[model samples]
Target: MYPRVILKETLYKKSQQKRRTSPCNYKERIFMLNTQDLTYFEHRPRKRPTQKGCIELSHIKCVEIVRSDAPIPCDYKYPFQIAHDSYYLYVFAPDNDCRLKWVRALKEATQCNNLFMKYHPNFWGEGKWRCCHQTDKLATGCSEYYPNGAKPLPPTPDPKCRFLDLEERIVVALRNFHPEEDTDLPLHKDEEYVVVDSSEPNWWTVRDKNGNVGSVPCIYVAEKISNDIEKFEWYNKDMTRTEAEELLMRENKDGGFMVRDSRHAGVYTVSIFTRASCIYRSDGEKYPLVKHYQIKETEGENIKYYLAEKYVFSSIPELIRYHQHNSAGLITRLRHCVSRNVQNSSRIKELSSEKWEIHPDELILSEELGSGQFGLVWKGYWHEQQVAVKTVREGFMSEEEFKEEAHIMMKLSHTKLVQLYGVVTQRSPMYLVFEFMENGCLTDFLRDKKGCLSQEVLQGMCLDVSEGMAYLESSNFIHRDLAARNCLVSNDHVVKISDFGMTRFVLDDQYTSSYGTKFPVRWSSPEVIRFGKYSSKSDVWSFGVFMWEVYSEGRVPYDNRSNSEVVEALNAKLRLLLRPRLCPQSVYDLMQWSWKEKPEDRPSFALLLHKLACLHQDP
Candidate 1:
């Protein structure tokens, strides 16, 4: 039969390889839909196309959206599975719109096929089922078809519109809108609305599909393409399972392995070595070997992993790192050979260097700048220059911890970031010398210049911080404690991100806090507060709060609430009030963009800087 091409597009196909623990490796492919078959090529055509794979339309059993429970990359925005017989093919589209189009077209093309009664939600790629973690790769564990499986009938003519009505309508909920006057609509996250009017620049009048009509800030509605996959540069790279496992194993020696959890969707638990012993015996064995422990999910959304269950961590790596310091139990004493192997590794030596150490006499302490839990910051003289010296308390931080911080500080130097000069380790109280800011912290500066400073000045301050954060993001650094208090203002009103105390140098840009680590609750993102997970996106969340502080002239966020109260409010999805009069609508929109609940939904600092520059340029 002569084939009729129905649709064609550039899409990514999940490779059939299980080298690393990660689910699948996505490769760029050109997919084409035809009346007779669904085929894909290795690349775009020029002279002749090399066929990668194809499936006969008659063999197609089912096609449906991959649920959130599937073991797939968080960056894979539009995932779907196509099952034929017992096997499945997992594919990813660039956006939701593209994915929907493909799904609709495929359903129409294969309407007459004799399909299977059930379909697996996950793809059986390579030699195993990545989602179910089943070793029998060919086994069809379970399947269910979508209720709306049949091809859609032609649309009925609308009496109101002779022409096809194509005005864009979006379903979204208000994230941070508070009604001030009687006419303003009090918007909440639960209420969904359809945009009826968006002609006015930054404000839109929406009719709640459920029958309420009111005007709301355009930024309050969540964008439909929040997790657009094209935003990531590494979305097209393909890696084998072996490469992933090798990388994970090379990074650390603490026996890390990923396993799918049956109860949770899109969640996996990683097992790591723990120092604590298992006191409880299993299967008539007393004092059983407790070499490893699985990361456990705690109450609410918090996750912790430990053998003693006393210390909880947000991620597996955090738990492993913590045990390296507090190695007190039978496991540590027994695993001498393994510990020696890790210690002798070149990575550990490179991280423990003392090149940053400075002479005690080089720094002359003057007046104290500020004091905190770690120690004090002093306005000091170092090498004939004014410097801010941070002195570590005698009992607060360990030697290893200090070295880690110093090592990280030495590698980073940016104009918008407070530059670390050197460290004084010979003295009783160790000192970290940094570039001094004449105007002190941003909080006090903003509070002092309230009403006097123009909106352009405030916008300039945000741009400065965003530039610094973009640098940090590029360097794979996460400033967990990003806030107005942690930022310093130069004499010329340029803001520099300071207080690298909570900063982490991460490979994947994700850092999980160890148990009992104190984080500023008010400025923290939802993930940081709930799961103790810190990333550049979490820093973006804090940046939103910081922007709010700038616009409100440094007023305390959630001022009337206690730390516990703020946590409760955050859990209930309440956000800071919009400063309508003080801040421009455009600036408020940027702030709301940063506060998206899903970390991936938030804009990167690079994107944020661009948006701010565009807003500043606008008259």
Candidate 2:
């Protein structure tokens, strides 16, 4: 049966032929969506329209939004794709609403058909399929399919329940609520509601005591518990301010205590005891003094807490708990009391072993090499040998976690991988000693020597990184953040992969990040960017971007786009532009091979290393 015509509009169609040669050219066309097919007509302004193309409803496998990164000349507001049998028809709409209307209509039209089973949310057209290895402009090698190369049956929808058996939660409005939308429920202060559906984390559908049934923001209400003890702990303070202070003083034997900031309401300042001279005293003589630890409030008022303006915490309890585990800042003095008790802990023992541990005194930190979220990297001397010392920021990481990371780094060693020498755990900021690369980071080196660098040098760098990645892949490790910035170069121009902070040892080669973990978007694979699912193949995707950076002389990938834009562009199946005049097409082909829509379709680092080696030999 043919799909009904729901909408028709005059739009510009990006010519497939023109896109390959002159990407800016767009022909005016009239797009019509009917029950049976999507038909496009050539728009001759003064004359009658003539049908140019039609995509049958039966052949349409998928319809999706395209967030293109490609340098298309026309500023088409909303670009989308319709994939059918190995080929994708890229179309652009005048607005986002128009695109959404078309996409929704198309999805609804195919909902009852088998074609709907092959639908993908983000799948868009890539130049060609890696499976068929076609480079020809007009070649359509393989049909559009999912990662597995088979069209699976559509998922069974969840059974509809007439009435949910979930508990009816009664809550009172904690504050005045204003509804942003017609479907949103507005509540007066102290108004009550019985929660019908608390499925959504932030918004809950509630039936008010007044019989109103609408969604209300979860933060606007509080649970209506009968007993004071069952109420929110923040509101359950029975002790007087004096009594609270007394208890806090007693608990904080080492002199760190939290008190409400006199200057700011709803803000608390943590004062930690330090031997440093008080602000009032300029005398060199040091005495016990309490100093306020700078706190940074993030996003929502009660949600996030940052210690010393660095370590992030979800709440006050989380912040206090972290400090209790790993005393730092002015609280470092308390380490004598804390570390002495936990010194024999299994984790500390694992990191403190004589073979892997180095005395803090031996690590003479020199000039700072670089700084990151974790801490700073310094060019230093360890046992008279030059080393790169990466220090974990005082409160950013706990002692136990830092030690575990050190243990993992020590286990990994390869010629093309930076070697972790030992860890210095005697101080507040723990030091991880590693083999110092005389040339510093690869990105800086490449950028500094940009036009002066030879193709052979760039090719060698790619091979070096691929070899390092291959070793990690074989060892069942996924380097989640593999880029030129994370790779270091030696005095002899040997490039070795570094930055193992995001690396994980996985038995299955796939590692999913915990919710809220931030990752660089430009170098990430589509799977990694969308789902945070990382594997060696994902690393290969990043390696492709890294190779682009190398060839471009350290130019940032998607330099013109924001992280969110880069993520959107990747979802659209757009990739870094190839410098055909500067680099060989063969090398660019390898980059494309790594950027296949399917992660499995991407080449392994081992295969990539072999190919790079072959390229090196040919050069």
Candidate 3:
């Protein structure tokens, strides 16, 4: 009351002090700013400190840091990041396409040394790093690291792959393809001057259009004739249709690599790496989770390289021999893939055991022909004719067992069957020679190049197998193993049923033995596995699984379960779920009919063939 009566100017001072001290009242006096202002402050470029020196700030992390800022074209790109010791290098491009172009440039410039140069403990390989670097430019002149081009130090060797070092092992975006060349090389063979069109030799007049002479040595004009064999090119494994076409166009425009042969016209070879797990099929669907693929590359008749996705073996013969004994050592097989210093046949021949010799005179052996449970296979020759020779370990199976296997194979002769050419059954080891199939096994062909084969192609495989089965049935033979890996393919789409090691001949259509080697129960009829008796009808049951294997791109049937569990489930009359959806309904219906537990209930192979033939005609 006394203060009110006094009503002094001190009261106004007190109120003003209170407003300044109160948080809510203080905030009311200032105008509010939006997040937009903060964003501007964050991205507004300020000069980097000068002391940083010659180092370009990577735009890779910058966009992420200032994400709210206005969009830049670089945000969509994949940055190349290389870390060496304490320093980290980053390269950001406008987009994936630009990134790929940059990568290509680096690859061309580095000469297979760019990846090693970019990483810590710099290292390189002769032709090893082609697929690893996105770009070929080396970071040079920096005192902090990689100073004076003193030849960057070699990488620490990986204990697993002794021949390849840490930085030397590279992961790249593209695969390389080099086809076999004919013995002859023409004048226009080089990339610069590929002959686009050539008419028949002008022998009409003594004086030609350019005043060519009549009597010249065969060598004088022979170079002008095109002699190179046609080639097929694979560019990038992950390429989209549009990207593939663009690459083709680029090849055409640049005129860097040209194929004069009509078969190789307008093509680019895509080199795939070892870890490459996906393949884009022509059907617009990408195949995912692939484990491996068998690859073959030949140059003239002198050199060949067997490439398993990324792993390259120096010679097919060595890989085959190694693959035979140790199936588990997949990567070890590639340790020998080194740069071609010279053409040495005697040295390679010396690498193998005295019992096994890889014929250097035959170029086909240079190419990686195929692989199997027994060992590495090669396209070889005997008596000057092409053949596939499978080399095995020294003490693999007893001679008696080898003879038994040979006897089983020698008796069979069917167009749909891979014929046994010869056998090297010496006391020291065992080897089998068979007719070479240019296209490789059906399992590999489908895995590498996937699609619904043409109706004609499908019919040919089906009919071929049917014909083979017909022979097996008439001879009272049972092909206990009838999967894709055991089947070979000819260039003409003909199928040959192979791998008859487990084959047995039955006196009748049933078995009385209480126990024997357990059948391939996954493919065997339920009655055969559960009841332990088999016949042609049991083979018909296996044919159903074979059909499923073909349709599903050789995916393991009932992939999640064990072979024993599959037998147990089938014995219990529980239906094994077909996982892949690509199988046709007709095939599914046929499998259900053939897989019935009662063997007698199954349809005949001839009947099944007729039904499958009908699907081909309609589908």
Candidate 4:
């Protein structure tokens, strides 16, 4: 606590003046704070409360020595050294026990590892200073010392301090991850497409906003270049050679013309006037710019424009249509002969300067929120809005596969499901931009409370979950993977489902030969486990198990039994033994209704929703 440091104007007494070393260098004494002074302040009593303060004492320490070889080098001992008026506090303790103790404290106070103690005049005086753990939230030099200088500051204000808010904002961008917005691709004008670049599987050379070069997923790139191109052709097959020449003359009044062999395919190979002259179009009709250049004999390679060769199967009318399609600039035909491997490596090793565009602040990584198997999710700001960015390991998936998955997710819109705001598929591991959930997953909360969710609360949760499933079922969607971890609970106990990565579009055929069980095996319906098929009814079966989880206070279902035991019990059609203390007959009745053998016999989600709702009404 800072005491009233009213610097009173009093002539120095004889003893105090004598102790001050009179005629000392006008260079003011740099009152270096030491360990003893820090300890004394902690134990001292004062007239007025210290203003969250610390004190420093000078000229009491041992003389400074330059040790050439004192068995340990200073630099080696201190990777980060503090030089505050010659009194250094090594933030990193060298000993294992002490270091671990300090590390734990720092992790609790602030997760950031790059903690730098700064001197702010308002918080600390000219010479004396105190500890303020730097955090990503507050600005640098913002003191962590509490208003009362309490040893351990009170927990950060919640629900903001719920680690989930920070964790949810992290997103990882992988190679081949593309910006879904603001870039043009070859798609219909009305179609929504993410900006994607097919770069190397591992495009390491990255240049961030600060011009600092580092290795990162290609999806982090904000912008890239689009090369415009066009081809030319003529289609009037009925016209005589003279008539064709006349038509060519009329069209070529502007600038360029060229032509080549049109002898093989049904359509003739011809050239005409275009953007740069040598645009190729399937030949038959006269090109407008043909008159720009006189026709002359040219070698194979020397031919600037080569049109399709005319053949018996080729129709002249079709060739005319092809010419128009090329002319419209709406179609861009990519040739297989053009090697992406060769061009990507030799021509543009890194992204072009012109192609580089700014990503919404959210797209740009701010700080490493955390790391996981997929990759790292960084906390970032997009358009001044907060978002979590998940970047995945490079080459984890194909670009096409990632894009297909993203397409499915983007098309889906449900309040019960977590929304997919943006996606990048140009990178190897794909990125999903989602609205950050303030409350952490229900799993964390359950684990924290020793899995002791009250019976009433657990029943209410069951209703929320069923309602969410009802919505999904109405949309003809199956979560495909539903578990306690996937179910998110807000601080206020509202349940919402998330993580549709494994979700698939349910078709009329209903059954898939892909997996024996489309849903999680542990929570799977008996039919799913035995016959390898799942429908909305199967989801109801899983919901029954999820209810068991909540009712049991999150005790692992069938935990004490082996996999074989579970399989055997289910095969014998055994009902799960519910804890009577926690679950009432109503709970048992609802679960039994859902866990019926046949899908047709099982109650619909709407019916289940009604029964669960009635439970709440009963209370």
Candidate 2 residue pairs in backbone clash: 2-35, 3-34, 3-35, 3-36, 4-35, 86-143, 86-144
lDDT at position 576, candidate 2 = 84
Where does model 4 exceed 4 Å of error?
A: 1-361, 364-380, 426-429, 515-519
When 1 and 4 are scored with lDDT, the better candidate is: 1
The stretch of ten residues in a row with the least summed lDDT in candidate 2 is 333-342
* RMSD in Å for model 4: 24.9
Better of 1 and 4 by TM-score: 1
List TM-score per model, in order: 0.47, 0.46, 0.40, 0.42
Rank candidates by TM-score, best first. 1, 2, 4, 3
lDDT tens digits by residue: candidate 3, 47-162: 43222112212211111000011111122324333332334333344354544443333333333232332232221111122123223323341111221223222223234423
Number of the predicted model whose lDDT against the real structure is largest: 2
Worst 10 residues of 4 by lDDT: 62-71
Candidate 1 wrongly placed segments (more than 4 Å): 1-355
lDDT of each: 0.65, 0.66, 0.44, 0.44
Per-residue lDDT of candidate 2, residues 1-619 (tens digit): 5456777988777665432212234567889988888899987779999999988777876676653212233445467767666566777787777776777787766565455343332222234332233555235323333322233222122245223316777787756676533446788876678877664334567777778777675656655644222122222133334443444344333333443343354555555444333334467554454545555578864556776565565556445544543333334322211211123222355467546788887778889988954799899998789999898875466554575467557656556789898887766677888999999889999888878878888888887788678767866678899999999999878899988877766545676663334688888999877877888999999999999989988888888999988878887788886563446788999999999999989998767876776677575
Q: Could you tell me how far off, in angstroms, the CA of residue 376 lies in candidate 1 after the best superposition?
A: 1.2
> How many angstroms is residue 188 displaced in model 4 relative to the true structure, after the best TM-score fit?
24
Cα-based RMSD of candidate 3 = 28.5
Tens-place lDDT per residue, model 1, 57-166, is: 78887776654322233244577767765556777887766777787788777767876565555555424554454668566555444434541222232344223225
Give me the displacement of residue 273 in model 4, in angstroms.
47
Specify the highest-TM-score model's number. Answer: 1
Each prediction's Cα RMSD? 24.8, 17.5, 28.5, 24.9
